[model samples]
Target chain A: MSTATNKKTVQLSHGGGGKEMNRLIKDIFFNAFDNPILRNEEDAAKLHFNGNTAFTTDSFTVAPLFFAGGDIGKLAIAGTVNDLAMMGAEPQYLSSSFIIEEGFAIDDLKTIVNSMATELKRSGARIVCGDTKVVPKGCADGIFINTSGVGRILNDHISVKNLQQDDVIIVSRDVGRHGAAILMAREGLALESELTSDCATLWPIVEQLIATNVDIHAMRDATRGGISAVLNEWASASNVGIEVNESAIPVCNEVSGLCELYGFEPFDLANEGTFILAVPKTAAEATLQVMKTFCHCEQAAIIGHVNDRKVGKVILNTPWGSSRYLDVPQGELLPRIC
Target chain B: MSTATNKKTVQLSHGGGGKEMNRLIKDIFFNAFDNPILRNEEDAAKLHFNGNTAFTTDSFTVAPLFFAGGDIGKLAIAGTVNDLAMMGAEPQYLSSSFIIEEGFAIDDLKTIVNSMATELKRSGARIVCGDTKVVPKGCADGIFINTSGVGRILNDHISVKNLQQDDVIIVSRDVGRHGAAILMAREGLALESELTSDCATLWPIVEQLIATNVDIHAMRDATRGGISAVLNEWASASNVGIEVNESAIPVCNEVSGLCELYGFEPFDLANEGTFILAVPKTAAEATLQVMKTFCHCEQAAIIGHVNDRKVGKVILNTPWGSSRYLDVPQGELLPRIC
Candidate 1:
């Protein structure tokens, strides 16, 4: 009930809004996410925004907390900020809230907080406000974080409804690494080389595309439902058919091998940092060029084009000159992969 | 792993970014929080905000999802919205994210979502954006909701640090009802008269105060650590002493009784809808006059005054002609208290 604790694990008082909670917040969160807006110490953060802004929220309950390459903390920040970036917005401010289960390791908490601080540097976003709640033991697994963010839209023209006919689709890199990595970690699969999650922040690449004036019509990270989900939604929203050459879509060998082993489709698996973009056919080359200059994006390629045929559907062209309707992913691909 | 289930409970595939998940979102969440912004179905909500805005985030893990007077959904919306209101901001757009444990009842989700929609009507705030994830059963308690909100600041001078030496402190109404109500609900205590949490939207009263142009110095909801916590923070933030008349402070008989039974201080109990305000001594009567017009604020009264005597401290003067330093709460009073 007081400050005294096992030191190895979190205590109920660590979230009690008292001296101990103050210590944890200060020693860990405040120290890592130190910023003027956060240091203001008000109930809500004061922000100045002009014109249009993008707001988004995401909750990360990824199992194992720590995966092959990233932890839940990294995914939490990247995922929310990426939502802003996909809207052609500059990631600016974020709010982090933690739901910690009693008796969870304190050292692990520090590590997660540190990962969050490190991830913030990827997009220059600041965590301005946060809340911590400790539940009774067994009430929660370990820790779950909910991050919400807002940023000014640098290019207001980007939207899922803006995918015009003849717009070319580009995958930022090889798809499905995130889902595969988590699967591998959870199933204890061994491979010749370790496969890490593609959980890096995509803002820098997005910023470059904006700088180059690539005429981005629609941008979305292949998270949760993965590329298939994003494409299906775009097709239905814009009332356009998307045709993709299966041979052209980038898929790393590790991801392909894992998909084969697990009887899953690479396009249906989640990707934390990977994104799919819709740009005018004329901007395809330029978009790919700009994307390839970024780390982990060397495999970026133009793989599809929007059309009026097969409205509200995605058609995938195979290597043998055959095609099939690429349906929206269905039924429990994976839970808590994010 | 498709939509087939017991019909009364939620399934894992409902969060798998597939047909089932889309159906769940539309049938439950979207149906309850119907609006153009939410219907757009974009990854993030597009909002236009000019000038200064107040942003806040809160995660609600309150146990017994349904409690006296309000549920967790109501608490989630009101808690974040209240933070904005306390900063003299108009509650506008809110983002809600949910972390659900697999196999939870679907009917319960509908009830919670409905509660959130009804609460949104309290301040006309729109649910502009949201996220949902389902963790395997036992990974989460039942459901945890995180709400992040942003709104235009109506009175920019409202801040804890803005407290002045002669500012009078006003207690919005009788305090400790929320904390006591939750306790009673959890313990299944039998009481002749029903006691409910003071959980209601405060923006209506706050808007009126702003419209009247009362020189508001500091405003804060006594949420987690209650009035004692807010006063201590204000005193420390402004380096001013606060002298509170114990007799003038309002405490309902129900709350006072529960406080005595639990060995808890009424002032130290959390309040969901109650707030404390510091205004110029000359405007105390005007503020009370405006507040009393509201439904739940009939007991509004001036409870204390700011002083220069004991900097960074709150002195509680009892009717016995003795005073004691009211310290900031320092231990776990109750966990998962909104």
Candidate 2:
């Protein structure tokens, strides 16, 4: 195939581990994600490590490839980095792997890769190594990205089972924006307000919280199953009861409107950038202050508190003075939301 | 869906970040790849590291899922581990991410997970963290797996750019078995002899080579683009010329026969378990003796030598004494052969 034609789309030979593959990698991935370790061009990247490290992985297969606020590339980077940041680690090195359809547009791939490079810069993480595979057109959708990251843990006190009685619960931002955004894109709904997915890297806010040495008992991003999943998991893992004032939880008008239209609970929708935290009541104010400094996390608030009663359960109290169990989502609320 | 039906096949809800997703993960992934690090049930796995490390990643989308010698799960582990091993690192921890098509058989999933567990034992590596995504039916093929690995470097001397003049080039066992085996399986050719893919992990053999303390210049697995690709890379990277005796490279009967029928060069065919090494002529005897101790490397021999005359080129000397340049394999030899 002519080089001009090759530049237009991804062909099978582009992933064939030959000349075409080499040129594509160098021209795109290497050029955008250039770093000393990557330039070595070895099968693996050589790195130095000391002390405790946090490792995590995530795969992004969101439909539409590009959604409001962020695309799959941005999600891939932020998702993995957030996982490490949740553990109070400084996001460092990441390995990206792509599974692309043969006829996918090269322009789109370059856009995605460039987005990834941009996202990596937010937390100073580098794409040190990566792999690419191309399957026949119908064998896969447009593309899927898997990012695995490793970082040195700055604080080792965060754990899923670290909640204690009287610890205050905080939400980093309004929940369900990611799910609402993807749903809107999929359904072709052009709302007047132009709602976007809350997809972003949480490392900046997380780094501040760690730097301030807030006694963070547990921290987790509300991803696939949303805040309900995080609250429910914390209760079960720590064997504590979590009582949340439903009205105190922040939710954007767009997400609440979409949830009502689809008969879905806001707590059940996913959020890419939102997170939940459990900290001693004394540290809750400081944590919220640090989080609110970030533009997207300005809505951070104390929505709940941990207690010993009703162990292993999450209770949601309504504004009407009634309460119900805020159970973990039971069915598929949304697929490929992040 | 009924519980029985749900047990028979994976449902979208199983990856929905809900109770069902929790059960699926605990029942399958956690139960098989059990380890303390994985059991922590956090967004990231906490690990301790010191000194130099090697990191790499790969995504496997091989067709047929299962071949004569191994399945996708085995290939996923072996491939990533080999990348680290080729860098003279002892494979330690791995992160697995799976993108599955909705409605894939649960039985097949179990078999694949079990194979992964079995393969992990071969290199003493743990699946410390993982992610799973399920796409709608027809959005993906059966499944694609991405594995990212981290290991401690056992020897820092091996590198693609470390080859030097008079370095003896060695091949571990036969070339082209993996490509030919996948092709046979794809074509459904019932060859009388079983021609299994050389899909074994290389850590054990590599560990011995390192322990022997034999001087080594560089090493790489003859994977996707095969030995020809490695020779060209080494020559280009180290600014040296590589001259190979074509007849000295081992080629099994089945692979040779299949290559002849398909009009493919053995040097350009992929091999999963086989590898190439560069060592000084003085250390060639010890290197070959150590390699031959393993059954698969019984035919290991010196295939060529590095010289300074023809930098950035690989020349092949045929049995008839005519020399030809064995250029890097330029086209797609086989897709998803890993």
Candidate 3:
């Protein structure tokens, strides 16, 4: 019977569901993600959920594990919570499962799990149930996490097809920061400015949006293919044309510089904490006012509008007064950029 | 863009959230797990739930991907749904996330996903949302799958702490087949007799037991640590003693042979589809009758009973009438046996 405190690294026994596995779970996971529901230690969590619930799942396989602003644990929690928040839901319960290599560092695992617990507080979400699996040394990378969330729907009107003609399109914050931060880390670049990933939990800001009763037609977080994917999906799903003023899109100087050097388009670069919304022209000003209250969202701007002029397409109007179709991203830009 | 037929192996572009990614999702996953909710094409799935629910998660990193009788996909689905079943819940919805290596075979992915769909039908569980991520070659062995499930609770009294002094302990089927089969695969053992994993969904049998109104105090699948772990947990949690008759426990000849050759204890080996149940002595016959009607559970047997003779421990009664304590399995006997 070896204590987890004496172990510096994880072994296959840590996942064997034996005495050692229980010790690690208690000394680490239980201590970090402690809650009434999680403390029950049942095979499955018993939860009380009623009416409509938004359910979403995401897996985090970010390279380097630790990034500029956040690590994989923070990303795992924020990613799923944001997915639920995008549906106008109150992030509630989450299940965190880990796939760790045989020789992963115990300290690193604890640090990652601690980050997850801290991030969960942003939305008051609970990690109710979990599973841990360990593979041989070379079977997997250092670690991978999967989180699935279930949230109560506070506003059920949000839908991809709910966009109306003449609706205003809003971007929550500056784009391309997350993609650029990861690229910089992978290339071992030490630039003058300190760039960081925009990865964060958006439920706090979203709760305010819902509480204020903003008539949000649709909402989505710009993740893998960035703002371009979200707008293109909306245009096709709603059978409406989206016109974006390229000059109005907010891109930080750091992100733009990285994009320029990497030959990447800012619109197609991913952002973890950023989101897009569709609102009636009448509600656009109030929406921006509520959004600006959050420091991280102070730069929120109206970059586009929806109409039937070019149905089922996204047209980007450059600052020089020339417009062109903004096609969805093709091929792979960077793998494991999440 | 290239057709999926022409792409023999998955490329990084297949996970880029663009034309190739969309094509891959549609041509492979959507075609296999096709349903209205999954085809809705939203960031999250909208589900309606009332009252108490059971939520659980598991990540499958089983070796060889395909084993004797089941693959990782089938194990992923059954493992999660069985957790819900153990909680006396009606399996309803699931969210699946896949982390695939860059050069994995598309055909193999199709086969695995198709197996998942087939397993889901046994429990009437739907895969409502999914995520796909591709890492560069050598980052992952082949593929890993995570499944999270939400099910409505039908019989809420089934809990590990609900065991009573006079309860009857039951084994749903033969034990240790799953662990033995995996060992056989890994060791390249070619015995004259056939051996396969006892991996299957147990929701049907559980539903029958619920409908029959058998007084099930607690139920758990004999998974990672096999029957030994479950009994020890029940005894410790319920503050009761469990006495098992070694002669009463069922073990297939092939499994016993493997155990003899490998010097492994059958009670400590894992069993995916087998389960343990505790019921009042009065309901023991009725429980066995209900369980025996299922073809897979033809060997259901009453292997033990709960008592206060030795609290917080499990005692094994030998055929010679002597008894000894059955402690929890200690170290990693096998990794990735799930």
Candidate 4:
């Protein structure tokens, strides 16, 4: 659980462009999506592409400008890079726009910009264009970021449409790491064992996939609405049903216990560091092997398989030996947990 | 001067997704950016392009989850299409991502979405992909929008760097209409003479430009930071100085009077319905003649002339027979004035 220090209504410390911000970034966002580009603590992620084009964008507005793990600077870069990777694109150029509240600290602004420059270096993306605006204090929550990315698409053959009926579903790692980490930080929930966020870039994993001839079909980062939302979207888009053995779905023991205590479903919680992949039966083994070379993918597994569109829904075979339909969440179960 | 009614704080009427919203949108955003697609008021903007590809996105977040200016729906579509026009790209496709506040009005959301459908038709763009998220209420200010646009690069000769000294600056008329209108609606700054926003699509203007064989250097829409920011950026980017004759710059009389009362500088004020064109001295006459055929360009004028790099700065020749250097605004003068 998060400590009391984590739960104070969002303060400037969260966006202060200081140590607190770094802690927040590492503890929450970085932990959720761990990967090489992010772990390098660089400005931007560098990626190489063979063909096609990749495009993505991310908007970030954390209550405080600075935080424990990172500030809006790192968040903006990492978020967009991850989005491109989710589409199997080699992240490249980026455009950033800032909406700042009136009377924001100029020093803080400079810090954020410098941090952004640093992260951009790491990410290997150039800031080609940018925009800035100021909103009345009451009209905005300090500073908000909107970043768009354009990358070279690696392979046109890899796409969501390629998913076969019996393709297996694989998650990069444990669930609820991102959501729970944020909750703990936001609510200051105390826990015997500390838990941090799982935010990190997945460019390395994507690179690995591109280098290998794995029969990967669909790929999506499990964020915002979490694993449930992603799976639902994939199922709907691919016109297939999914059947998962709950016990096979990887979940950190600590996260599972925390979710049980909070009455939150691990599957419903958001995870910034995780991604979902659909692979053909024959390619699943090789794909999982490639993924395991990355630290965050060690526990990855094929927890489910695609079904015919006639089955058109998600079902979970629970640990209790009971089967239940998992419907697309109608609304957000954990708001602002991103 | 604005009336007392125009000074009241914004309420649900500003984003209600109804007649009030329509009024607010027309009176502010649309009024500032008047163009063919916007005037049509269709479901999407139809476009014709001859290039590799185009990109666009629209993100909407209206506080209270709704607004008088067609809610998050209309704004999202219009905003994205407009962005494409600024680049002289025919908006071909768009992507939307929604960050909804938890417990928002469901019916309101549907209205916004429906509005987007209509606006997209009017603009002649397609909604190719989308994303939705519900954040806890306090984490967001009702709703925020982020839109991306994609269009073919059009003519290979079009580039900002093409701007040369002696180029004439042409502005789409009625400066500050959108910014001032939004301010009035948002702040309830009522005036005896009602002012409307200039938020419309400029694809037609862009199409017209393509039809004209006149030499063009660069183009930019006066949004966000407005004409002052745009001019300064264009001057710096093109490595040329710009001299604007104050009397020649177009300004709606009502907006001028309001700025006088509010101590805002018309040049520094934001404008959505306006665009700046930099054309070679030789092609200036023909370009202006062609532009005059459009209603939106009625008040268009040759406001300034680009000069050599030695004078690579913006200068204003005042009505008082004096000249003053107009520096790029170091900070935002009007918060959320856009």
Candidate 5:
């Protein structure tokens, strides 16, 4: 069958561990995140740590375990580690659980497990424990992964409720890479420019930021509902309003073009690699500088500021010099893009 | 369509969090588990603690968001808290994350969340932090949940490596309840005897066990591959073999009959609410007595013993005077049952 015909539907081949799987991981996920640890393509991630313990867990069931920029294996590890990073933690260990569809290819599973081991080693994390279960074929789409991570918290004050007035909001690198990549992968929309999913571990960038000792109030990895959801959450949790300069919010040209063509707002899309930092306004520049030292975050910028007025609200200054309310994206703008 | 006509197919209605959902939770989950925390149907479990912290994480993605015993919400809380309990910890706090499908019903979502809150209260655990993501409809089966728990570790020396030669293996209550329940739910099988999934929290039983001070070496919930898988894991981890007296192993009559007819070994089936304990052979009777104080564990029994011979192996003595090897069930025999 031609690639076009096959492209419209997700087949078991998409999840098969082979050349296609490698292409999917490198071309989409690697291209977007572009970090040394991830690029190394090892079985586990190697990390450095300093303080108290931090733990988090995440599960990925992105339909078509094999997606445009990544697969469930990569997504699972990245997601959990990012949560630890958000806490300014140095990830140390991970426990993975697999819920596989009965009849899932054993070879395919081995491939995924191998990839996970590689990613874990590369990120400086170890798989200390794991659980596997098989459900009847029709009961699951293909495969789902649950990863629980433990990290050493480098900074004790890093928390969602730590934000204060005058804190600046800095976004790491560009937004919408993950959302757009998954969209293109699912819709089969070919563009002159290909968009890759920004699925990656943010520990390195987070580690660098912590080392700088720049005052950070809170940090969140913008995953689902993109920047919009995270900002709203931060505003609500910190009891502060946020105002963003639209032009300062970075978005890759390819992603911007795709979002425009698809009638989706980039702010509402998910981003696996991007993080929002709420820092003391005076420390914002230093934070951005430290973040930029990491290639994945070279384009980091202070896009917004926490304000005293309109607490619990997020406002975006439009390109036309108009301000608009940025609410939590009501539902999924782009599904399964993780 | 008539219910009979819908056989062999699972629909979104199964996960809708309404009457059908209640029936599934009660008839299947509650019947098997039959615990006070679950029967109370409150907003969070009221647990008493004495100085130690407990921690655990569980991620659930049943093809049908809702299942025979419970939805991802209840499963998320129960699964994680149980893990903490197995470690002789008192569950106190929990964190939950949801991967929701874009088109999932808002009402259903609310119900699931509320149910989770209720289960948490019933288990005496609090939902302290959480996250939500929406994946496009086809990108996810429906809704998947990952829950991590923090509890105080009350007892010391509960590690698997603590197992000693001649330690007796005690199982709390009947085996294979959860697996059989899921099978019946999936197959839509009806019989004179009803079998429900034993999906419930075991914190109370575990807490009682710890209080009795019976020289427990290790404890594990018999999930996924069931009692056999857990025993095998214990043996391998502790560098010992487990020899079980077949007649001493407790199996519900209905579950036994179902296993026989389906060509399944009860030992290989999953049981969410059941746990395996390795205690000094001399303390087995006392442990069983403590277990009886918990209503759900009235059928607790001393079924096996840890031995130096056949290290890292699991041996079962049959009623017919034959000995057979019980290996980890290769691959998943039942999917999404947990």
Candidate 6:
């Protein structure tokens, strides 16, 4: 029979579906994501969609909650939004659900909610509907957020199986920053260098590519298993072999150092905002030009090209002019990277 | 660098975005919720939507996982589907995400997924997209599920703020079954009589009502906080008063016994499948007739009416000829009852 009034931390009563729960939702979630659709206060949000739409979902359980570049809040929003953007969709409406542990600080929740609001602004997407569940202490970690997004598809040609022969593979920027940054934070390594996660909304850049009509064949963000995973999936799905020059792939000094020290492959490390693109050879220069215009993607480069010689495989050519198969990562590299 | 080859329980590698993870998704998830959209294998599922759509999201963290009538899997599907049905929408697409703890039994995970697939068949809603994440042992309770759904809005007139004066309020069936069932399971009450949760998909019944052309004003499932919370919300949002006949509200014997022993009110308990509807007095008989035709809602009855006597409040008329304000339930009734 405990009341949650004037409490510093969340209580079980805050999720009891009663007066206290209503007040908490209005105070935190509604206050931060204020909009007309949300204010309607209906059981669900009513929206208009008149064409091909893209729907995606992701649950963020990144440990440490906070990191060098962004917190779980920003990652939750950006992750789902990027899934839609990678399909050449205009990120529009998102639904967020939170499972918070009891006794979690109100201040921390507010900070996370505010971060979500800030990230939503980058893509003009609105948090139209949501649910909150509070579990007893020790039942769960601090909190986990699941975001599901539905957006209007700007181009229907973007897909993993759409890669064309002789298509150029482009890495948006330096790989492995996000995975390396998280590793450093977990290892308690306070490096003197500036190494932050490449965690930002990619809609702005994707929109520019779409507006420029750069015929994107295949596009995917290297999230969990990084570029190696994406290349393998694309190779199998499109039945094309990928040839990449290892020396041409961009890797920051910090990430390379972390990988060297930890015996991890840079290509297999996750990236929050970095994405790989497969475009026709004729559109490669135009795509690179558009991507480089963005500050975060200034180092975007052509890393490889699609070929049929080694079908259903990814071939990496090292600086020594010897090539080897870059198979799909078979075991766990890192946990909770996203 | 351990692998999950033929493992009986889940490992961290199953969510590591590698070979093991892909195999698990394909063998279990893709096999159960199979459909063309899901088989497309894109970052986002491409859907075609014309006109208005309804979107909603929910996360299920029910303790014990299994319950008297429905498990968390079925609850997760029906809960989100019911939200869309409450808005006079046809549930169409759903995205499911699972957060599993390391070492959770593969057999149990399969059963939950099977339950979700079974429930989705009730509303003809397809799970078009999903995400899965696994944490280290003890980071989460056995498992948690989050489902987000989008559907086409059939009737835009139904809203929380659309209640008109003299609108008759009809409850679908007896109240408090869901909350009582969960409580009983948690407390280990071996009641002999049948006392199962009313956790079924309500779209079929709602569709019948919509097809009958009933002029529905406000409709909401009495999930958490039961009918009391729903009525209070309607009154405040529509700026009207609701007068409910206390005795007219139906309550099962099991629920009554539990409430009497626990010093609780049945009005404040939760019901998963039970719902309340507000329609003009002329449409009241039709609504009840439609509801009564369903076996689960055979006890459908008119319990209240909307009026301007007391703005933004609910009044309960007792059998003793005395009336009192029915304030929204306060404090915690039960946590994780969903």
Candidate that scores best on TM-score: 2
Which residue runs does candidate 6 get wrong by more than 4 Å?
A1-6, B1-6, B190-193
DockQ of each two-chain model: 0.88, 0.88, 0.86, 0.13, 0.14, 0.85
Candidate 5 per-residue lDDT, tens place, B221-286, comes to 887667877787677768898899899888998899889889988988877778889999789889
Model 6 clash pairs are: none
TM-score of model number 6, chain B? 0.97
TM-score of each: 0.98, 0.99, 0.98, 0.78, 0.77, 0.98
Q: For model 4, how does the per-residue alpha-carbon lDDT over A114-135 read when each residue is reduced to its tens digit?
A: 6676666655666544444444
lDDT of 6 by residue, B1-338 (tens): 23463388888899999999999999999999999999998999999999999999999999778888899999999999999999999999999999999889899999999999999999999999999999888889999999999999998899999999999999999999999899888888836648999999999999999999999999999998999999999999999999999999999999999999999889999889999999999999999999999989999999999999999999999989999998889988888887
* Share of reference contacts found in each model: 0.90, 0.88, 0.86, 0.07, 0.10, 0.86
Better of 2 and 4 by TM-score: 2
lDDT of 4 at B154: 56
Writing each residue's lDDT as its tens digit, candidate 6 over A1-338 gives 24464487888888888888899999999999999999998889999999999999999999878989999999999999999999999999999999999888899999999999999999999999999888998888999999999999998999999998999999999999989888888888746658999998999999999999999999999999899999999999999999999999999999999999999999999999999999999999999999999989999999999999899999999999899999888777878887
- Model 4 Cα shift for residue B280 (angstroms): 1.7
lDDT of 1 at B314: 96
Report iRMS values in order. 0.8, 0.8, 0.8, 10.3, 10.0, 0.9
Put the candidates in DockQ order, highest first. Answer: 2, 1, 3, 6, 5, 4
Q: Higher TM-score: candidate 1 or 4? A: 1
Candidate 2 per-residue lDDT, tens place, B145-240, comes to 999999999999999999999999999999999999999988888366689999989999999999999888999999988999999999999999
Provide chain B's TM-score, model 5: 0.82
CAPRI-style grade of the A/B interface in model 2:
high
| Per-residue C-alpha lDDT of model 4 across residues B179-220, encoded as one tens digit per residue | 566556666664545676665666677778777866667777
Give each model's whole-structure lDDT. Answer: 0.91, 0.93, 0.93, 0.63, 0.69, 0.93
